[model samples]
Target: MSILTQSAAFIARSCARLLAQDCLLCAADSRSSLLCTACADDLPRLPADYCPRCALPTPAGEVCGRCLRQAPHYDAA
Candidate 1:
């Protein structure tokens, strides 16, 4: 029947979608194909406490001591 044929086509398309997706940032192959899990995990997340100038990780709520005493020579201080 036409209804059964339509159902079959729909099922086929759905199956195709289920097979894979692409990585979001790089447009690379992906198991999920939408910001693949590894790429998502690799994304840089800001730590709670980080270097004021460089944004590198720092001990939570603590400055690196040297940075607190005086601005670096190049800091335009």
Candidate 2:
């Protein structure tokens, strides 16, 4: 990453350490981030068998039917 971006992230982390922040979802103490660990982990993740092109859930983990019929502009989702 760029130096400025890195610096900004460092400063943000430092500030989070100094200030007690509440989780945006649960209103619990999150400390270093906007979401508590439990809430963060509870968030939905992409399915393991998702299509690589469109990120739609696929039974065989291959490209979805939509992408196969008409390809997406970009590559992997």
Candidate 3:
């Protein structure tokens, strides 16, 4: 590797070590991202069935009733 690349990597590692990145929610060690793997996995995820127009959770994979009656301003969600 080039000298500049090596130097930059060293500096980054030093900074990371000094800063000691940790998960905001769990206070676990996080390498680069804000949240750790465990905390990120525990977060609530959106369901597969959702209204495309309004992006609301729905039983069927279709536009919500409200959106159907009154079309949304934008074409896409």
Candidate 4:
């Protein structure tokens, strides 16, 4: 590896160690990330029956009505 890459990585690691971040939800120290491990784990997960295109909840996991009428440019959310 290059000397510059190694030096940059070392500096980044030092900065990460020195800096402590707070979680958005609980305001606890998360250290480099916005959310702490516990708060991140407690967050809600998307349901299985969501639209593939727009990520909206669907009854049968099919495309949502809105997407059907006016399709989005992206294939998936």
- Clash counts per candidate, in order, are 3, 0, 0, 0
Give the number of the best model, judged by lDDT: 4
lDDT of 1 by residue, 21-61 (tens): 66778777775447867788998888888776555567874
Poorest 10 consecutive residues by lDDT, candidate 1: 68-77
**Per-residue lDDT for 1-77 in model 2, tens only?**
99999999999888877888999999999886799999999999998899999899999899889999999999988
- What lDDT would each prediction earn against the true structure? 0.70, 0.92, 0.90, 0.94
Give the CA lDDT, 0 to 100, for residue 53 in model 1: 58
- Candidate 3 C-alpha lDDT tens digits along 1-77: 99999999999999999998899998899978899999999999879998998888989878899999999999756
Please give the ranking of all candidate structures by lDDT, highest first, separated by commas: 4, 2, 3, 1
> Which runs in model 2 stand beyond 4 Å of their true positions?
1-17
Task: Point to the candidate with the largest TM-score.
Answer: 3
Candidate 4 wrongly placed segments (more than 4 Å)? 51-56, 63-77
List pairs with backbone clashes in candidate 2: none
Candidate numbers sorted by TM-score from highest down: 3, 2, 4, 1
Which candidate model has the greater TM-score, 2 or 4?
2
**Which 10-residue window of candidate 3 scores lowest in summed lDDT?**
53-62
Better of 1 and 3 by TM-score: 3
